[model samples]
Structure formats: C-alpha cells, structure tokens
Target: MNLYKLGKFLCTVIFYPLYRIKVIGKENIPKDGPVIICSNHISNFDPPVVGITSDRNIYFMAKEELFKNKFFGGILKRVHAFPIKRGMRDRNALRQGLNVLKENHALGLFPEGTRQKNGEVGKGLAGAGFFALRSEATIVPCAIIGPYQKFKPLKVVYGEPIDMTSFRQEKASAQVVTDRIMEEIRQLHKNHR
Candidate 1:
C-alpha cells in the first residue's frame, strides 16, 4: 500500500480502539468527485480524526513549519500532505491545492488556518474558499470535538457538502465564503451538543 493508505490503516486500528471515536453523518460524504473537507481546527489530532472517519484518502495542507525537519517532512510528503505557509495567501500553496482537486481528489483543510486549542470556532482564513472556487469543488463541512486522550470520547461529524457553484457565479469574496463555511461547521458542532 502507499504511505498514505498505510498510515490511515495504522491510525484506524490504533485510534479507534485507544479512544472512543464516534463518527456520524459519514453517508453525507460524496462517494465520488472532488471535495474539500472543510473543518474547524481543534487539536493536532483533528486531521487524523477527520481522515480516519472518512473512507476517502484526504490530502491535507500541513503548515510549512511542521516540515522543517527533513525526516518528518519526508514522512508528511509521503503521506499525501504538502506544506502551506500560514498567515498569507502563499500562491504556490494555493496552486498546489487547486491541482489536487483538479485531479478529482479530496483535499482536507481547516478554514481557521491553524489549531484552536480551546475548541471554540475561530475566524476562518480565506484559503479554503479560494480553493473551492478555483477548483469548482464541493466543500464538505466536518467538525471534530474531544480530547485525544486514551479512553476519552472523540466525536467527528460529517455534514452535507455545501455547494460552491452558486457562490462562484456570484463572484463571492473568499473571506465571505470562508466565513459561511465555518458557520456550517459551527452549526454542526452545535447540533451535536
């Protein structure tokens, strides 16, 4: 198996048993076609939590800083993650994301741009919306809640895909679209509470 699939298999075996990981609305995920897995940033475990809960292979936009170490960076790259510079548009990163979608693959990302340790929703950066618009991909709202501690319940909810085609026609601002996406995620969390 490829590195990404291998990692996913290992994580699924380990994470599901180690933690009480409850997944809901998985059927809402589109079985085919390019999709943006837009989610709220929680802890570092957010990616794997969302990744493992879904059947698709999710290519994540990991922060550039995490790739500073060559050894770790290699592993990240092998696992289908690419470096993204945070707090800026970073055109190259944007292009990379669009390319992933153009190939009809799932691109996983956090609209907030970074993790929020407190679990409260934060203002979303415009990157996610920008990618969805450029690639004409549907954005699937997902929410991950819980501590990554052994035996603690970790909840992951996959909401229905938020159509971006209408927004593209209206020429919606990336910031506005991103905020709307975040709101969808927030509502998902609220419903689960």
Candidate 2:
C-alpha cells in the first residue's frame, strides 16, 4: 500500500481504541469528485482525524511551520500534506490547493486558518472559499467534537456539501464566502452537541 493509506491504517488502529471515534454524515461525502473538506482548527490532531475518517485519500493544506523540521516534515509529506503560510494571502499555496482540486483529489484544510484548541468556532480564512469557487469543487464542512486526547470520545461529523456554484458569476468576496462556510461548520458542531 502507498504511504498515505498505510499511514491511515496505522492511525485507525490507534485512533479506534484510544478515542472510540465516532463519525457522522459519511453519506454526505461524494464518493468521487474534487471536494474541499473544510473544518474548524482545534488541535494538531484534528487534520489526521478528519482525513482518516473519510474513505477518500485526503491531501491536507498544512501550515508551513510543520515542514520546518526534517523528520516531521517527512511524515507530513508521506501523508500527502503541503504547506500553507497562515495569516497572509499566499498565492503559491492557493495555487497548489486549486491544483489538487483540478486533479480531482480531496483537499483538506481548516477554514479557521489556525488551531483554536479551546474548541471555539472562530473566523475562517477565505482560502477554502477561493478554492471551492475557483475550482467549482464541492465544499464539505466537517465538525470534530471532543478533545484529541486518548480516552475521549472524539466525534467527527461531515456536513452536506455547501454549493457555491451559484455565486460563481457574482463577485462574492472571500470573507463573505468564508463566513458562510464557518456558519455551516458552527451548525454541524451545534447539532453534535
């Protein structure tokens, strides 16, 4: 098996027993197509949990800092994660994200832009919105409940794809689209509560 799947298998072996992970709305995810899985950023473990929970191979848009350490960077690379400089509009990162969609692969990212460990839903960056509208890819809002710690009942809920197709023609700002995405995530988190 490829490193991505291998890593996922190993994670499942560990996550299943440790957290007793629960996933909802798997049926909402399209089996095949370019999709943007956007979720709230709570912890470093959030990405792996969100990615592995889905059946699709997820290519994550991780922060650039995660690549600074060679050893950890190698692991990130093996898991199909690319770096994105947070807090600024990084064109190259955006291009790479769009390319992932153009290739019809799943692109995973945190709309919140950075980790908010407290589990509070915060403002999201427009990157996910830009990718969805530009690539016409479906945006799947995911909500991860509970902490990433062992013995906690971690849950991940994948919401229905947010259709941004109609806004393609209009000049919708990134912030506006991001607001809508964050709202969906909040709703998912609320439903799980």
Name model 1 segments beyond 4 Å from true.
none
Q: Pick the candidate with the highest lDDT.
A: 1
Best candidate, TM-score-wise?
1
lDDT of 2 at 57: 91
Q: Stretches of candidate 2 above 4 Å error?
A: none
Per-residue lDDT tens digits of candidate 2, residues 18-39? 9989999988888888988989
Candidate 2 least-lDDT 10 residues = 165-174
> How do the residues 5-85 of candidate 1 rate in per-residue lDDT, one tens digit apiece?
888899899999888899999998887789899989888888877889998888999999999999999999998899988
Weakest lDDT window of 10 consecutive positions for candidate 1: 129-138
RMSD, every candidate, angstroms: 1.1, 1.2
